[model samples]
Target: MDQPIWLTFIVAFILMNVLLVGMAYMTLFERKVLAAMQDRVGPNRSGRFGLLQPLADAVKLLGKEDLIPKHADKIIFYFAPLVIFVTAIVRVAVIPFGNQIEIGGQPVALFAADLNVGALFLLAFGSLGVYGIILGAYASANRYSLLGGLRAAAQVVSYEIILGLSLVGVFLLSGSLSVRQIMLQQSAELQVGPLTMPNWFILSQPLAFVLFMIAAVAETNRAPFDMPEAESELISGFHTEYSGFRFSFYFLGEYINMIIVSLFAATLFLGGVDGPGADRYWGLGVLWLVLKVTVFLFFYIWLRGTLPRFRYDQLMGIAWKVLLPLVLLNIIVTAFIRLIGNGQIF
Candidate 1:
């Protein structure tokens, strides 16, 4: 059953704020982590342990002068950043955070909309984000910005195919595209000398997990595959002409996209909200989801600190020649395993 309209609105409003706050802190987390890796002190001036750095950054961005290219398309320039920011925030609606919790003796699901085709919706929305990138670049009236936008579009188009195929193995194993049902299917417990653990897809489809991670990083335009805004090649890439809150919008969108994919990885492969004690306390499930997403987010930061960006040709090669065939094979092999397990094939 669908949630009450009022309740849905309340949940969405709360979740949206949570996402925005999380994105803010993600920057702080990345900076501190990178600083540690490089043997230096990070943002410690704003608040205790630099907890207030994000807020400070937000204030600074807001107070900075908003600039536009003299020859820019005013309407597209104004709306492009908003498009990216809104689309990035909206994809969280279909992700199931936890099973259910009670409030005032009434049971409430932990997600906003439990779409039947949640996976497809994610793909569609993710693809649409490219439009914002392209539009922003074109409206900037800058050659470098256009080149960055083209690279981004090409990278997204290539990686998206592998991203979808990688998840086909999970969908095949779970027999559903709904994120909630997939998590439910993974809820079955395993026993080993009285120790119980959830049966996550990561163990069964390790290859898929690896492929998905790579494709997701590329899709989000992160390091090692962040050819779009590569500082060496294109000065800040597609949003080069944007400043102040306009630039901040694109910045927030990127981090939010990172969070979204991290959540997807957790929910799909790591048995989201399925940690020990989750069954006993619904609130723990939410904590588990958060913990899992945090791990992936940290992993993302770690990669940025550790790995060098890939060359433009190498980026395309990895998507087409490496991840593509591997994911296709994984899907085919998963299907055959399912058929044989069901006694439908020898």
Candidate 2:
């Protein structure tokens, strides 16, 4: 029908496909990096440098037997993976990858939706991720699965508060809840003595950046915080009973969530798509966004390679005792500074 609506649909479709393919390759990339770290050559058989490994794994998974425990709850078990996968995908809708691009003489944003409340929407969907884990564990009718699911729920709950609070500094500085608006605030060039640089929120709010990343890593249940699915003890955790495509759904969900977190962090703290030439060329904006996201993704894999998993008690303690207070202090300090700068306080 209209140009903007049609363009939005097209971009949304393209972005979704790109994210799915990216998530697939991320697994390959992680394996290669991890192997290199551990002094192994990693996958080199399926395709050149194992480029087609993810595809081969997908095909193999598709052909495997789909099994459900005899005593499992049929409905919840059937839908758990789908729930997780869909929720993970939904979180990306509001993420702005690039600025408006000219196509067919009209400008269109490189995002599915541009809601003013994008930040709140991202956090809300993120919180729902644990539901799928809980359902999967309960529906499987397994004790270990249930334990893993409960752990995941608690872990998510603990860190989610810290995650939300950690971003308060960004929201205060940007004065908007929209992710794109937040990036816009950081797109300005700042001058220091004779040097000029992008005024990314990361430079001003280093504390928030660190807190956000720590909580984000915990939120995604990545290494060190991966007690829920600690294979050494939980035997694959909540998805233990899942097999074939069902298991792949959970795997896909995790990688997609990881990508979303990195992208959001890039947008909030690293100035999504903001860099030299980004203002002149929309394509460069996309490139900058991708580069920033790539760095964050590599950081995730690096942490997994080097860090040992945290103990259950230590994990909860870090969230409640350490991150929680730091985030709260960050918020208070940020608010006070903003007030003083605004001449509202002496």
Candidate 3:
């Protein structure tokens, strides 16, 4: 049965809302995680264990005054963050969350949309984010915003080359571009204490995984790679002129973008939501999926806590000189492995 269509949309909407909410709290989680790493106490007053901090923060942002600079381009100014936010969430449609679920006697895939070119689609959507910061800064007409936007565009464009190249190895190994197909291949790879282990691509392609992680962290404009939004120097960077929800939207886009990148990392290298006999056991599948994504989230915070910010020249050099070459080599080596196995050449 094709499902009632309405049910499908409703499920998707609810899932997206949950993801959005979760992304908000992920900020709190990052802070808590960072605090623990640094031997300090994190937020504890907002709620039990500070569980309600994100909500409190959201309320605070909503209550703040909205500001629009008098000299800004009012139209694109308003549209920039929206474009970025929408693109971030919209890309989620193509990624499988926990396989499929039987709801009311119908098996519904847990993704928003399954694209033939799902992985490529995700990459393309990621590229769209560069425009958000670029346009936001450009329209703001502030020197800081404009400079931040330029930095973002350059960073994203440069790092994206490495990002795409890193994935080519996975696509070659799986012989498919669909995210679903890639997950199926990953699921076939492990043996874990009587239970077949989830064959995470991370193990098979360790080099590519490392390269991908570096590129992805850069792509998200995060710490160490956050040259665009350099705080002390640029004064909040691109969103310097933004306030209240307007500022919040940029951040909202950021955390949500983090989720997307983490999930993509999970999907491509972490075997997504697959575990031992997950197809046969409904709950286990969800567990594996969450576990995989959580590992990614943990790594994100760990990097934040452990690594200092990279200088602009150093960042670009790593992206172009180190990462790009490594990615290309991974591709060449993977292609050679495939060819020899197929007896295409010696």
TM-score of each: 0.97, 0.98, 0.95
Model 1: weakest 10-residue lDDT segment is 189-198
Every candidate's lDDT: 0.92, 0.92, 0.86
Off by more than 4 A, model 2 = none
Per-residue C-alpha lDDT of model 3 across residues 1-346, encoded as one tens digit per residue: 3667887797689778978988988999998999999999999998899999999999999999988999999999998988788888888887787666887788877777778899999999999977889999999999999989989988999999999999999998889999988987887757766876557788778999999888888988888788889997899789998898888888988888888888888888988877777878767876787777788888888988888889888998888888888899999999999999899997
- lDDT score for residue 58 of model 1: 98
Compose the digit string of candidate 1's lDDT tens values, residues 117-189.
9988888899899888999999999999999999999999999999999999999889899999998888897
Superior candidate under TM-score, 1 versus 2? 2
When sorted by TM-score, best at the front, the candidate numbers are 2, 1, 3
Candidate 1: clashing pairs of residues: none
